[model samples]
Target: MEFRILTESSDWQGIIGEIWRFKGAPNDRNNPILPSYWQFLQIRLPELPETPIPKLATLSWFLREEQKRDWVDHRLVSIDPTLHVFSPTTEQVVFFWHGRNPSQGVIHPDFGEPGGSPWYDERPRLPRLRVEPSVVSNPSPGHLMPRPAFSPALTSAPGQVRKPKALSIILPYHNDPSHLFVPLQPFPDTRHTQTKTFQFPSRYYPLRFSQSNPNHEPILTNDTNEAWPASELEGLWLGSYGPHGTEVLYLHSPEECRINAWKVTGDVNVPRGVITWRFHSRYQTGPECIPPAAGLDSLPESCRIFKGSAHVCGTGFIPALESWIDCIVVVFDRDDIKVYWESLRHTSRYRRYKGRDISLETVPNESDSGIRVPPVWD
Candidate 1:
């Protein structure tokens, strides 16, 4: 979706307040632009199999649910605006910019997960490169960066069938060229929408909103191999580097949500991290948890909260349990919760929740010992 900021401003709320004065640029008449945030964001049924889960709320009531979810729309990680070239393959989203500043560039993997066991593979496998820029321009919105294009070492027979390769493209913050990781033609698993559980190879690193045992915390023993936890973490995504290195982002799902939380087991790297630990959902309705001082602490003291509009009336509503829907985006280190966006329903008088609402208490009570599973396949 293309969003041409009519009047760009970092203050999102302020722009929202002055929406009455909003107008799309005249040059972009070919695109459908709405007068509200609805125009800035687009919603289409994800290209995935329909879930069989029963719906409790009516479609007419779903608008109010969306509004309640929008309250925290700002909390979602922002995609860099300078990114003009977006490469969405079966394996990952590769972004390229011609003149983007690399120094200020930081690739935020939609799926960032650091420090964990071999969720899929243990030993480090070399990255594969695909997608030859010289041959193609404007690849389909979600197309695969075929391996043979980039990697000469790839060996695939003429008639014998081969599995579709998954690619992970990694590059510096700002660079004209990018690299891809196309594993052996047929990786252990190549199903794009398929999700699985895996463990971290290390102990539960401290991440906020996660529980930790004081006694089991890593100690600075005299052993030379025992390296203490990292104090400064760049960020967490669905994929992680090997025991010593990092890779480009490699995750693709038109319909998928990844969640990760830090945890410790009797053995290191058995299960993946959980998004939220059990805590009281009810708060005092004031400044709740004190923000942990910026340092080595991995946990986020403040879990993100999203609120949207009225599903029924298409009017605004207060933050209520029924009004707020819960949607979680789990990766390797950080887990983000999203409530749906609100809109007016065709019918209905009362408001309703659009999606699900997640809080400490509302989070599912799944076993923390088993391998952490991706929410999409679940």
Candidate 2:
């Protein structure tokens, strides 16, 4: 029932307003959020609001609205964390763009109202860098840069084979607290026991855990000392790379199915280089299943179910489990995708930059139940 979006730049308030407008309600009665942009997000699927979504709350924002004017300049609402209400079995959490500018693009009517709206000409598309098609033409002299020289052993005999680049991709949540991947007998935790057979709630279920019992605190206990956290992860991103475009990517899965994660696979053309991705996943699977793999041909690889723990306690001592992989960032160059796991890594330090905020939740629908889609956002 919670959602969040992280950004390097601040403008969170304005982005909130944009999301409201996309829902067909742009201005707030007292304070308004403006001058924003949201290109990435991480949200829970079942908690998306439906036909008549109630009040929206901001759990945490980059800067307090009370202290600054146009905090949008340097301080943006970098991360937006909110718990929402929705019918679990009835609605699907969709991630789409929101805006009032025709120059920007379009807006969805059902985003807020199905037909009741001063609808824009078109709905806005998710923000993203477009990838150029691979040109088959001959490379110019300067463009045809030489590949880095390989060790002589690689070119030794006529029958010798070139080795594939060994990419030691680690999707770590926190800087590696490297414990030898040992078999632990379910770290004496009760949450795992209570959630052992808990079925994912259907969309029609109106009452939320927080709503039903405000007294219920997310599992909090001290193994060595004391603790605290929230349900959604903040500062989330993805990372991956392959020798040629990415041939494979392995990331940790979510501990629970409560939140719906996202990943976009395409061509990301930066001034420095190009990142092309052939596949992306928004998969929900168990720890026992083999980790899912994406095929190079665009077909999503089946989520590999496996048994393990990648759970971290968030703001309220809430156990944030990787029920699903949230967002995957893929960078592409000639034939390789430079995927950075920054999204997956949990760093204590904060990075600063200038930009707008984006606060769109993943609205889940019944039709999308158990279905996996690529290009989740843009």
Candidate 3:
């Protein structure tokens, strides 16, 4: 067994002396002197006289002589210091301390006696001490377990034709048609048509179509009061009325709107299926433009642009309108747009400032247009 001695002090002689005082009376038969202590004394104190004297008797004589000469305090010498020993191999711990027994004025059962002064060996041989060796081995191949085989029927077969998954459409405000309608500037020729050309309050503007049908005219039908003909309805389009320089437009349909559609063909590099749009005031300014002053409270009243995209999915016919609609539309308001923009800006700015070892305790106020200033931490 491997033994380690952990001690708070390096005064070995003081420790030994402390152990000797409580090592029991001189006539006790069951003396607690341990084999380890005998080995320690043999190696550490070979200069002691070889005269035969009982271990307890020698210790008593030395202690008395020191006390009489006032060389050491008898009271201090009687202290029983504890020794902690640990055997790693055996996983055993032994705490040895010399003290008087409660039942009889003798050494405690757990303490070991100091080795006697006149140590003698009656037997020719002492028991040999050896540490048992630990064994380590790798698991055998026979013990290895194999993974269970999966069923081939559960996997797709070669040359199998997989059906396209239906895209899920989340309607804004429970599929309210009023929310889906987007207004746009009238066509150029309609500028003087005398049919309320500039602002058709009752008509819903159609910004895009699935197919390029020039024959399809923008006829304001009294029955539906729509700006465009029903036959031309084919894809999806997002439109917002902003100042000339800040207009944002997104159009997607079966044919003409394909350019704006995010194509998902199982490739990771390409954005697929569902797409979302949210208005962020910060990015409204062009790249070359500087951020406006923070004191500005609100956006320009003239720029009352409705900015946001409606989610659309699948192709189906609306029984109520008796028209075929290719996509479902979901719209969001200015409040939703503002919230999204603020959250994104806060997160991005936090990461950037943190990387530069700067504190973002107080964020700068947004400008009049509600556009947050880009953070630049030194």
For each candidate in turn, give its C-alpha RMSD to the true structure in angstroms. Answer: 24.3, 25.8, 41.3
Which regions of candidate 1 deviate over 4 angstroms? 1-92, 96-218, 221-360, 363-378
Best candidate (score: TM-score)? 1
Off by over 4 Å in 3: 1-161, 164-210, 216-270, 277-378
TM-score of each: 0.16, 0.15, 0.15
Better lDDT candidate (2, 3):
2
Candidate 3, which ten residues in sequence have the lowest lDDT sum? Answer: 346-355
Error of 2 at 51 (Å): 46
Q: What is the C-alpha local distance difference test score of candidate 1?
A: 0.20
What's the TM for model 3?
A: 0.15
User: Candidate 3 lDDT, tens digit per residue, 121-225?
Assistant: 123221122322221122221221121322000101112121111111111222122111222222111111212222111110112213335454433222222
Name model 2 segments beyond 4 Å from true. Answer: 1-232, 241-260, 266-378
lDDT of 2 at 15: 27
lDDT values of the candidates?
0.20, 0.21, 0.20
